[model samples]
Target: MSAGAVADWLGVACLVAGGLLSLAAGIGVLRFPDVLDRMHAATKPQVLGVLLMLAGVALRLRTTSDIGMIVLVAVFQLTTAPVAAQMIGRAAYRSGRVDRSLLDVDELAEER
Candidate 1:
């Protein structure tokens, strides 16, 4: 087997894994009992799935500009996802949408 074939196979694998993770994340967001749990589902696996998909695209493209674009996308995703999730979680908490019973420690409650 050639190196190119191996790379293609790896790329396909990454794409498939990423797709599955993304699907799971979507399902979790829909199925989780609370806002916090839904937020967790939206951010964690979704970010990883996006990164994996980018990796697969980079591997398949194998061009400098393409890889650079992918890196930029990855950077933006890493920077934005956590911040977005935190904001959403905070908003939910502030609106009393979060289920306090599910949290082991409600540090934010002390501030209230």
Candidate 2:
């Protein structure tokens, strides 16, 4: 009934949701048929999962310095994940791991 208890419960809920998202990402990576799909599965849910986990940690810690560090980590994860996924996708495309038939727009096709 207290505010502190509410915060704790919220944090625990976030952690559980994050864990589920991470598990979904793992399953998606394993079940997806190709590189692009796999990368999609790996990046989207994984980033969300990490962010959620960090949010849970931040909520639980509830200190300025710790919260700042968590924010920094979340920012880093958000920034790097997409870039890394783009690189991986490009690599997969160049190496012929991507299925062209599934592509509705092949913008990169003109680049090469």
Candidate 3:
């Protein structure tokens, strides 16, 4: 088999895996009971899924500019998802939308 064929197969695999993860993330966001749980579902798997999709695209495109753009997208996703999740979680906690019983450890509660 040629290197191109191998790359194509890997790219396809990444795309499929990413799609599945994204789907799971969507289902989680819908099914989870609370704001914190939904935020976890929305940020964690979603970011990884986006990165995987970008990797697949980069592999298929194989151009400098295309790969560069993909890297930028991945970086932005990694940087923003966690921050957004933190902010949302904090807001939910402050607004009393988070269920205290669902949390194993309540570090934020100590401040109150």
Candidate 4:
């Protein structure tokens, strides 16, 4: 009917989509059967989901402070999530918990 109504609907939809993506990521973590797959799902989708949620909230609020906070949060997530995921992957690798079926074997050991 009105632009406001449409915007509200869109905001709600964004939040719902974010929620669903987050749920999917969680399910992927539980269902993927390996750490590599879990990382693949958790890192990307979680970042996207958080961004979507911030977008929805920012759009719904439509205030300068809210927008600023949303931007800060999105930036924080964009920066930290990848670093965290990389750390987890590296930790897993150093500790020898990888999916060998999906990749080439480590040759360093053989060379040594």
Q: Judging by TM-score against the true structure, name the best candidate.
A: 1
TM-score ranking of the models: 1, 2, 3, 4
What candidate 4 gets wrong by more than 4 Å, as runs, is 104-112
Q: What are the runs in model 2 whose C-alpha is more than 4 Å off?
A: none
Tens digits of lDDT, candidate 1, 5-111: 88888988999999999999999999998888899999999999999999999879889999999999999999999999999989999999987987899988877
lDDT, candidate 4, equals 0.86
What does candidate 4 score in Cα RMSD to the true structure? 2.1
Task: For each candidate in the order shown, give its overall lDDT on alpha carbons.
Answer: 0.93, 0.93, 0.90, 0.86
Off-target runs (Cα >4 Å) in candidate 1 are none
Compared with the true structure, model 3 gives a TM-score of 0.95
In the order shown, the candidates' Cα RMSDs to the true structure are 1.3, 1.5, 1.3, 2.1
Q: Using alpha carbons, what is the TM-score of model 4? A: 0.89
Ranking by lDDT: 1, 2, 3, 4
**lDDT measured at residue 94 in model 3 versus the true structure, 0 to 100:** 95
lDDT of 3 at 29: 98
Candidate 3, residue 3: how far the Cα is off, in Å? 0.5
Better of 2 and 3 by lDDT: 2
lDDT of 2 by residue, 1-112 (tens): 9988899989999999999999999999999999999999999999999889988888788999999999999999999999999999999999998889899999889674
Q: Per-residue lDDT for 51-78 in model 4, tens only? A: 8998899869988988998999999999
